[model samples]
Target: MASAHHSRKPSGRASLPRRTTKGPLDAVDDPSLASSRHSPLPQPPQDEASGSTAQQSANPQPSIQHAQQPSVQVGEPIKEERELSFLFDTSIYHPLSQLEVPGPFRKPFLPPPTNETSVARSLEQLDALLSQCEFLRAAHLAGSILTSGTVRPTDSKTVFRLLAVRYSCLELSGNLLLAAQEAKALEDLSSAFYYDDPNVDKAEDDEVLQPHRVPHHIMPFSLRLQALRLQSIGFSDPRRGVSTLYDTAFECREHLSTPSTTPEQRVLWTERLHEVSIWVVNALIEMGDLDCAARTLETIKPGNSEHRALWTSRMILVRIKMGDMAKAHKLMKDSEFTPEDKLALESLLAVADGRYKEASEALSKSEAKADPSMTALVKQNLAVAYLYQGEVPKAKSLLEELINDGHSFQTLTINLATIYDLTSDRSRDLKMSMISQIAGLQKDQGQSRAFVNADFKM
Candidate 1:
């Protein structure tokens, strides 16, 4: 009775149609059924006025759109930066053209040789110029030879010869520093050749097929001797200078006696020996070593009239310094000298003998008018005579004249200072000023205190 009542109630509500649910197999077989089950529900048409309101409800903030706009702008710059980076990077690796590529480093260019005979001809020309005393031309020619790059090891002899001659030329031309450098090069070459065949004995016979002989120590020694002499004279150290001169003299003598010395070399050594002996004697005299000077002079036999005169004059001067006026007068009479020289010597002897009037008369009578040096010497001696005679005014006048004439000798300058000390009535300040001037002159002439003292005693 309950089931019949329920069914009668459902029929009374309305004679409703039966609703059917589709199975999976039916849905798969029917596209319309599958589409209807999967599709979204249909919505009612929205008015324009309500569309914005719905969109605003869906997204309440404008931050997302603002953020996205900035990201787009920022991304554009990032892309441009990436492109620029790629351009620079690729350009470094791959140049656009061959001209844009860097070239390899290269050395500086030196000029090529002008001709094969250029060096030889230049050397010959230099020799000719030097023989003619044309040192400037010779210097230029030597420079060309050195710069030519033709000085091979095989041509060392020629190159070394040129170097030696070049050094001499430069030295004579007053290029001391450059000459010293050249001389050092020659010394090095000499040392190298000396050790090249140290064990081998030098051949005695020129007829035999001999090894190349080097002028072992002589060349370097001579160069050093000349250098020492120059330094001594330039720097004013006669004691050391004279000692070195003596040493060089002994060496030259020893070298001359050696059996290895050839006739030509002997001639050169003898000449050098004589020259060094003369220097030794002079240096000894300058240093007040009269005994040594006399001994050294005894060893030096003069070769010519010029040498004889020179040695005799030096001997007379030494004897005069020793207060042996009798021997000085004897030497003056025996030696053949010019009229002016004899007069000068006589005046010196007269001064030593205390004959001031005779010395003054002899100095005044000297006819050395054409020679400025001799005139200056006469004036100096005359001034000395005047000082000895107590004629201070005359002595002062002569000294002042010499000073005005620019007499550069140390003796003259020292004498002037002595006269100033003895004769001047000026204040200490004036005397000091005059002394300073004389001192400056001494310094300019490279005079040492010992030299001045010696000159003063003389």
Candidate 2:
């Protein structure tokens, strides 16, 4: 980990867009992320829900809502305020970059926080904006990485930020394109994206690796980017996208695997636990490989208290969804899941038994202990649980608060919105208006990645 302490330069200044070019140091080259002595490889930022939610509520797609907020008559003024802020943010993009992208990317500051709390803190205003097109973004990204110096993060802040940049880029452009197109040209032009310069391998033994340059996760990401870009540009296929992701997953698992067995295995075990426990399960679910992912749970379960409980709980959710209550119960008992996970497990069981009251109570207990996020998740689940119990408003209210969090978990949001629709007795127009706010919340949060990008130099 390296600390990124670039000379306190002004971030997100309004500069005329740099002309994107092909070839070395152009659209593809990124200086901010690279290697040191041609090193190891890489990683998605988070688990956004898909198009379905177990919970339903009235909601509209926020993308549609964003354009209409200013004129809305019924919604909260906060949304209107956010609209103003978003437009201001959007305006900066017009004057800054020749390459178009979402305004947030061009701004030195991150996207505006959806919740009201952050507005009081130092939310630096945006200056530069980017176009939303994929190719220009791709080109800009290549150049940014090259000029940014691909430096190793010496601290947690930089590491998180480095990871964020990697995550953000992949989120926006995780597809491949025709090798001959401008986007492809941008992809091909990036030397930094190459895990390593082949010529480096052939350089005279005396000609050592550069002083502070080596591709870390850069190469793996580059490989995926090329593949993903192709997918983005009408490649007429998903096979490549799926293939690249799994390959990347394999590489990630390999990079994370331990070499030897010893007491150190304990530490390695925990690290691996965090990887699969916190991310792999959810990531797999998002990728629609839940069944394949479930098999990996056995390996992921390790000798740690929190992770062990989280792992067991996650499996219980899978089993519940799979309708395998028997195994879910057995594991629940065997793992002796913590109070929270146990409650999650029990709630699922209660739901099947038509014990709605028991399910709600159990879910409440589980949710009581969750952090704001886990609490929100529990709340979203509560919406479903309530719907199961025929308690629609309880479910609706639970989702409404969750909408405040505006999680991008595609499934969670969709499920919540849909459930609200099913459960609510309100008129169609009223429901749509309310649900649309939640959607906007999700959209706002998605654009504003929480991973603070800290610049790090070796």
Candidate 3:
């Protein structure tokens, strides 16, 4: 929900050699991808019957055959110009049966346009659908446009943007598995084949490569981040996620270290590196490599005191999760965390130590609410502390108030449903009523209004 100021370019200056970090995801170590950077991908073995047809179809440009002429040998420049534009297969637009989506979210109240001709209008409609939290419909429409064979092949920016939207909507609408499956289309995105470097020959002479010489052609950095995560999850390979994130971080670092990088680019790459490091830490944590996660956390140096304090607080929590309570306490004592962060840490420590009343008191402090970002988290913790202190009614009332105020967080809804099950014989009716009330809530044009049945713990 927060805005990122980083440049969305897919690749940093290609001449900057990717630096490898000792982290959980070692993408540079993958033989399959590492070997791809220097050479063209091996063409699949083809039979005589279908190879020519496939090749011709693959390159719709008539001039594609010029490279095969006798005069145009390997390493020789062809006289004719070739269209190297990339296009997605039409198969990606296959009809998505409504039966595939969850029943409750299958049909949107406002249907998406099916035969829109204008790309601009279709893009507008897609944004409107997403704003209304009509994710499934948005996903369908996005997929249609992306794979419609209508967008110009050279317009990589728009193509990847739509891809990101389609994947994002699918995941947000609770079709994570489907989104992951679709992510396989983005294999080896870091391969040099995707990039167009007109000045690539100069690299052989050890010349200073200008950034503008290598324009980005791969998916936007944001989409690449999400896609890599999705691919790793879908393929059941957590290490892949870690490695790819490390690879991206390496690229960011390379950009930061380059003297030719503009001040704007330096700042953007710095932020991107920080974000990538955070993702690497998360991937490490998910992989149950807590020590690696801690090591990775230390590599991130935030630009501001506020960010530093936030990261230190996270490090303290990681230490706690690693069962090093003494280290967690010592880190907290040694660091200069903001008052809000300190209160949050203290409450977390108290909860871990079974001091629910103390935790509640700390979270109830005005300082705990100083940061709007921390407010919901503090309230959630307070509710948990209330429940631990045997004040179920108070906790229930607080959660209900949060819900009534339009904080439709899944945890809040599920916790409220659990309380209903504990206190009432007709909990199902209560949950259904809650769902109905949520459905009736007025959603703003650009706000997410989608809700799934699972949010109520059904």
Report the number of the highest-lDDT candidate: 3
Native-to-model Cα distance after best TM-score fit, residue 336 in candidate 2, in Å: 3.2
lDDT of each: 0.47, 0.39, 0.59
- Show where candidate 1 strays beyond 4 Å: 1-208, 211-215, 218-223, 226-247, 250-267, 282-289, 367-370, 406-409, 425-428, 431-458
Clashing residue pairs in candidate 3, if any? 25-242, 25-243
Q: Write the per-residue lDDT of candidate 1 for residues 45-100, one digit (tens) a residue.
A: 11111111111111111111110111100001111111111111111111111121
Error of 3 at 447 (Å): 7.1
Winner on lDDT between 1 and 2 is 1
* Model 3: residues with Cα > 4 Å off, grouped in runs: 1-116, 201-217, 301-306, 366-377, 443-448
Q: Model 2: runs farther than 4 Å from truth?
A: 1-193, 197-290, 303-306, 352-354, 367-380, 397-420, 423-426, 432-458
- CA lDDT for candidate 3: 0.59
Better structure of 1 and 3 per TM-score: 3
lDDT of 2 by residue, 149-229 (tens): 232222222322222232334334321122212222222212232233223445465345433222223322333333343
Measured on C-alpha atoms, candidate 1 has an lDDT of 0.47
